[model samples]
Every structure is written in C-alpha cells, then in structure tokens.
Target: MPSMKEELDQSTTPPLCKTGCGFYVNKETRGLCSSCYKADVLKKKASSEVPKILDVNNNVGNQEPVENHDQSNKVVKKKNRCHVCNKHVGVVPFSCRCGESFCRLHRMPEKHACKFDFKAAGRVVIEKQNLLCVADKLEFRFFKWWELPDMVFQSYHGWENWLDGLRLKKEVKDYLEAKIARRKIV
Candidate 1:
C-alpha cells in the first residue's frame, strides 16, 4: 500500500485523504490528516502548558532567554540546549555523527568506525533505528568524507592526497607546507 507521502508525491492535484477530507497544510503545518492535526493541536496545547525551563524564582516557565554563563571552574560549561533531545549541551558540544546536536538520545557511538561522511563534504552518523531514510544517510556519509580529516589524513595515503597535485590555496595550505619544508631542510 502507498503511504500518504508517496500518494501526495504521485498525485498531480493536491492529495486529499481517502475519506475525501481536505487538509489544512497552510499556516503552522505540513501535510497532516484531520485526525492527526487535531491530535497535534491538543498535544501542542498540553505541551505549551508544561514548564520547559525554570524561571528566576525557580518556578516553571517557558524557555529561558539566552545569556552568557560564566563558569570558570567547570570542565564543561553548559551553553545551549539541544534542539532534538532538549538537554543542556555544554559549550562547544560535539556535533553528532549525524550533524545534529543530539544531547544523547540521537547521537551514535563516539568512535572512528561510527563516523559517516556526507555527500556534501561534512559529518554524519551511520547507525539508526530504521533504514527508511537511507538516501539522507548516504549523502551524510559523502559529506563527512569530503569535509573532515579521515584516519591518517596527514599521511600520503589520505583520501585528499589525490588533490595534492592540484594548486594549493596559499591561505589554507601554506602553514603545513612551511612546516614540511622546514623539516626537510633540517
């Protein structure tokens, strides 16, 4: 059976539910079945009432406004909250292998083997709960390989070593070249 997203993509006209119900995808929504939309509204209302953060008086309140925190003693200074997991991430939290700043829930194991390279030259995570979004994973893998340093990236067999023959960017590659040249002359 075709999923709703598949059906929507296939239809020339805007797709309606099989029940002939028109959906309000406009204003604060994507494609949502009527039942789901109502449920979402209710969920939002309930969630809005819940205190997301503590106020100055230590009472429940909405998200706190951003302010610089001075914590010189702590090893990890809490900076911002993770958007996905809603946990306080310390200053300069390591981006997940997925490029998402997941507090802990969505991040993969922090190991070299778990890292995936994205198609657009950046980092991404490999493992997941499901394989439904495989294309995204592949793109992310390519990105990581292209953008970040690989194992032994400083060595001759590094992936970007092929580009060694190409003209180097003076601003970016000059420092490394200088160090190498100095070592060779010594």
Candidate 2:
C-alpha cells in the first residue's frame, strides 16, 4: 500500500489535469476541489427532494405555443436552393453552374459528358458576377474559374485558361470540351 501523500501526489500531477483544470483536488473527494465536492453533494441532495409531478390546474402562468405575427406576413424568398432536391442547405465546396446551386448528389457525376460544359458557349457572362450556360433552352450558371479561391485556380490548366479569359475581360469557351469528346468516344 502506498502512503497517503504518494497517492495524493499521483492524482494531482499535471498530466492528470492537462485539460485546463489542475490535477490537485481535495484528498477527501478524489480529483474534485473542496468547493466542487460540496456543490455536487448539495445538488444531489436538492434533486432528491423534488416533487415527481404537479397538477396543471395549479399552474396559471404557463402558455401554449404561440405563432409568430411577423412570420405570417413575411414571404421567404428562396435563395439558391439546391437543384437536385430543392432543399435550402449549406455545404462547403459547393458548385454553381449558371447561378444554380447543386448539392453534391446532383453535381459532379461520374459521367464524362455530364462533367463537360455544354452551355459554355452561349451562356451569359456577368463581368464580375458569374458564367451562365443554357442547354436545351434551360439556363445554368457554372462557377467562373476566376471566382474560385487562388489555391484552387493553381491546380488545373483548364481552370487557368478559363480564368485567364475571364480576367482579360473577354468571354471564352468552357474548356470542358475534351470531356465531351471522350464521352462520345470520338
């Protein structure tokens, strides 16, 4: 059996309490300080005396769920809901083609043709805003390569070309044509 001092020292060492709280606590309460030990005992004692239940009739100040007055009058504008499921959600590294925000499920499929920019040619280009594509008479906006983070731009030649065109302030074709050709097996 170790001496009481040795036992206390072992428990109060720095390694044991590296999580902000120091290790040395009152010996009577293991690792807890005297105040903490007293507080815990008091809380337990108070909880033990609480009544199990009470009649609702005796409570007069309670209220039911109230509907918000402003909420009823307000019309929520759906801003860039996901194209796949149309759910308004926030996810990082999101892809936007022609102003539509596509969640991961609907964006970037394994299909090579789908990955290419079909609307890259006729799509609208907003000088500082976006790059839009229209396919089958449906409009889609893809993220302009320039708008991407700088670190992301350094990764791909296609993106670099696309960004160069955008930065030069002239409209150029989307560089995803190779993927389209590959998909057609041409």
Question: Judged by TM-score, which candidate is best?
Answer: 2
Instruction: List where candidate 2 sits over 4 angstroms from the true fold.
Output: 1-20, 54-186
For all candidates in order, the CA lDDT equals 0.53, 0.54
1-186 per-residue lDDT for model 1 (tens digits)? 889998877774545543346653433345666676777789999988885554578644655766656688559634366645577767765575454564555455443234555543422233343345544343333233233444445564643454465455664356445544564521
Q: Estimate, for each residue in 41-153, the C-alpha lDDT of model 2 and write its tens digit.
A: 89999999886565677654675644548666888655556656776657453455444556666655432124446455435444336745646421135544333565664
What TM-score does model 1 achieve against the real structure? 0.17
Q: Count the backbone clashes (under 3 Å) in each candidate.
A: 19, 6
> Worst lDDT window (10 residues) for model 1?
138-147
RMSD of each: 28.1, 23.7
List ranges where model 1 is wrong by over 4 Å: 1-10, 16-29, 52-186
